[model samples]
Target: MYSLTNNQLYSMPKAVRIFASSALSLGLTASLIFYPSASQAGKNDTGVPAELQGEWRYGRISSIQYQDSYTGQSAAPNGSSDQFQLASNGNYKRNRLLQINTYNCASNLFIEEKGKVKIEAQRLTFQPSDSTSKGQICNSGRTYSSRNTAKPETYQWSIETNEYGQQVLVLETADGKGKAHYGRPQ
Candidate 1:
């Protein structure tokens, strides 16, 4: 516990001081990074709409696109350019990026999945057209393959304008385990 006053802490042994300071520093950093600020807590928005099709980008990386979340909300800001090529031919290819924010560093991990997609009424079904690999890509410690494309992952999706006025495609995974939001980078 940091019960010692600043004066007392300064008088403590060097080893004790270093350990305590390191622990405190790490805890504070973690809290600050994860604590949602007022503007980030949540904003008023029209929920996912019933129609979402065509192409969308995460930000500006023409090669990078779509992101996934358990809430189906926009994971990135309104300026991301994640690309999604949704075609009427029931074929699609999109990049999924997972941001690892830690170690005083930020890294983007992505995997591209391609397959056949069908949007009927309110249901969106996907049948992977490529079974070779999901294409594992990591911009970090090591390259790892993503198991996201082992089989078809379907979702019920809709389009909506967020509070920031960006058109977003929101979806919930088939297993009810994750929700994701997609939008055109402004």
Candidate 2:
């Protein structure tokens, strides 16, 4: 019968360890060469999909100047600039004015409008507000006692792989009215 000491049994030859490690590494490499990792295995299963869940600075509206031909006068001659910000926490603010010019002699004016919006997935709903409007020349103005002016708006958004292997976000309004392209921040 053959007997081995504890140290002898526990200790392994350096060459044997090296050969074993090399074989194991080679096996792993071969497996990787043949079969992809779980992450690279399937389409639409690229893990949790990217969402439009972040703070976004959607540019700015500037140079909103208007002039009327009949009066040969400028109402908002200096014009104004404003910003729009959207957040993932279902919160949005448009600290700006939507300029709608009659492009006529009467030259009505609308100013100081602000509102909040909520966003979910691809859908967006805006809290309604009073439609307060004013007439410049005629000195006639009225405030509509209404909460929501229009319907709750919804849209579709998507994340796509770009040419650089990076993900991008594409947004389209529900009514097919507007579309926007965006990319992840650096």
Candidate 3:
């Protein structure tokens, strides 16, 4: 009833050592081939990557050159929150809320879009079947549901893992003007 210690195993013959190392390597390679990580779980029914088939909330934005303001109040206090819901069936819904605060007034805008999304190469094209937008400018109030006649919006996209190990979806404008970062709603 003898047990081989690590020292005894290391002092074994060269042939035995090589064989043991090869066996260990083969086991690791086989495990990797059989068990994939969550991200590598394969595509959804709509062909969306497994990592991108979920709800993501707006996190931040950065322009290619400078910080561009959507409300013209670049230095003023502003807040925005958006959500992108991607279904495995190729359907998606986006809800966005933007508020702008100026020295004299504040404006708010909200937009909701529902559509089918397609991913090709590194681009994601959203063809909205329906859309609704409502906003208020200072004091004036307006509510409207208009058909989106604009062409399908497409963006270069990728999922990046931050230092904190959180998945962030980076969507760059088709024109390469800016990138919007989104993450899971905490």
Instruction: Name the best candidate (by TM-score).
Output: 3
Ranking of candidates on TM-score, top first: 3, 1, 2
TM-score of decoy 2: 0.35
- Please give the TM-score that candidate 3 achieves against the real structure: 0.64
Model 2: per-residue lDDT, tens digit, 1-186?
A: 011122322343443233222222211000111121123122222122225444332222224455676778765432222233444333444332222233432222232223445544344444424223222332233222222232333456555554666555444555554454455556
Off by over 4 Å in 2: 1-51, 57-71, 75-96, 103-139, 148-151, 159-170, 180-186
Comparing 2 with 3 on lDDT, the higher-scoring candidate is 3
Worst 10 residues of 1 by lDDT: 28-37
Prediction 1 TM-score vs. true:
0.47
lDDT of 3 by residue, 62-160 (tens): 221223356553443555666879898989998766555445444555667899999876788877787765555544443323345223677887777
Rank order (by lDDT, best first): 3, 1, 2
Question: Can you list the residue pairs that collide in candidate 3?
Answer: none
**Candidate topping lDDT:** 3
Q: After superposition, which runs of candidate 3 have C-alpha atoms over 4 Å from their true positions?
A: 1-41, 60-77, 142-151
lDDT of each: 0.43, 0.34, 0.58
Clashes of each: 17, 0, 0
